[model samples]
Target: MLRPMGREDMRAGDSDRKTVADQLKTALDEGRLDLSEYDDRLQRTYAAKTYADLDGLLTDLPGTVPVQRAQVQPHTPAAAPAPQTASPARQIAQWAGPYGAVIVVCVLIWAITSASAGHLTYFWPVWMLIPLVFGVCGQWFGKGGPHRR
Candidate 1:
């Protein structure tokens, strides 16, 4: 019969080393270890050959429970509720709000310039408005539009 696996003699892998490295990084971020100490521990973590070695590095830290086999639970089936689609008006409002703000700001600048410069010049804001209008229209009518959701 096969025996249960034990942690002490388990071989450490690259992912295990990376997990330890990430924990060390978090500790360094939280002021638990200085740069030099963190660097030293990180190097040792990558060099660790077995689970025991990895466990030793984290022994002083809180919440570092040794890895164990996950307990399996019985599976059950329950249908999840379907996601509700946004109303066409809601989607239009969402897409329009930012674009509307950009158009407004551009028009305000153009108007202020025209007033200062004695007369209305080229309707330069139309350049900004055209592409935004096209995008909004595309989003409203395209195959991948929000309404399709």
Candidate 2:
């Protein structure tokens, strides 16, 4: 038989802290908390060590629920972890894949135009290529890309 949860005596874990933090963020987003107050409460939420402590922080927030520690059953393995977002390199590759095709098409068009004109035109393709190169370099080096929230 399992014992009932007694909130006062229960210890909080990382997940519990994260849950309350998420709720606090929602409250902040909803304009319930100003910047300073939200920052203070967020700090306190992470510092909370017990379920009772977490409960106190959320008492004033609507729809907030007390954190409950997850229960484990014997003979069952834990569920697989959630899929991770693609890494920066993977994201860059994915973006580059189609963009590379576009560049190839642009080069083909430039080649056809030059061959028909019987002389090389000014490298107009460099206009397209310059920005693309800079953008990719920015994604590679600038703050780890804009996809990061």
Candidate 3:
């Protein structure tokens, strides 16, 4: 008769290896492991065959527990969150508020400079409209956030 598999002897899967790889990446990012050490641990992590093999790789890392076999749980459907949509006016106002302020400021500066010079300045403020144009287009055409596909 086949013996039952112990927890430590459970076969590791891609998800398991991925979890350990994430931890190793965190360790490296946090300066817990140097590049060479992290590289070695990462190699070993992917090659690990069982929970027992994966467990020891993270023993020295702080805030880590031994990898355990994942338990199966009953599947339950979660309630979907209600979709939020903004009114057309509200969407316009959102982008318009900042853009309007910037345009007003730029135009005011241009007006003052033209008044002092007795003619319209080169209208350098027109350059400021570039970003506002892009923002307006993004607001109207972008998917997601009041315009989700």
Candidate 4:
């Protein structure tokens, strides 16, 4: 009898997400697939939680459109993370990372929790600058952010 598959062990049999993502990503980067379609497939593939689903997605990829994958040494540090700041929407998502959650939490604690506790009421107003600075830094230095990308 076959043993049940472990949750984490469940993955593309031979194909890996990174490889597949890289493949699709490379193709998209090379302009082989239509931009809109590339976005769709990529979004679908990543959204897929199972290998079976991923395989299904790729089955339709070759005929959908063709693009070349650039050879990148895995050992090399990834280039700042993103490329082509063509759309404002893409820019927004890209810059939303880099510990935004933690920063927001910290800001909340400083602005609301701490201020309420009377630990830092004097400087609570400075929290107003948090979002602005975060926005500027994220725009310029975030991994997937604008300009840096």
**Winning model by TM-score:** 1
* C-alpha lDDT of residue 143 in model 4: 65
Q: Which ranges in model 1 have alpha carbons more than 4 Å from their true place?
A: 1-6, 25-44, 68-82, 144-149
Over 1-149, each residue of candidate 4 has an lDDT whose tens digit, in order, gives 99998543465543455556777877777777788887887777767666655664555555332212335456877569665445544565555655466666667777886667877655554565578577766655766544453
> How close is each model in CA RMSD to the real structure?
4.7, 12.5, 6.2, 18.6
Compute each candidate's TM-score over C-alphas: 0.65, 0.42, 0.50, 0.31
Pull out the clashing pairs in model 2: none
lDDT of each: 0.83, 0.82, 0.85, 0.61
Q: In candidate 4, which residue pairs get closer than 3 Å at backbone N, Cα or C atoms, i.e. clash?
A: none
Name the candidate, 1 or 4, with the larger TM-score value.
Answer: 1
Which is superior by TM-score, 3 or 4? Answer: 3
Instruction: Indicate whether candidate 2 or candidate 4 has the larger TM-score.
Output: 2
Tally clashes: model 2: 0
Cα deviation of 70 in candidate 2 (Å)? 13
* Model 1: how far residue 59 lies from native, Å: 2.7
What would you estimate as the lDDT of candidate 1?
A: 0.83
Q: What lDDT tens digits, residue by residue, belong to model 3 across residues 47-122?
A: 9998888989999889777745336579998999997877655787877898899889989999999999999879
Candidate ranking (TM-score, best to worst): 1, 3, 2, 4
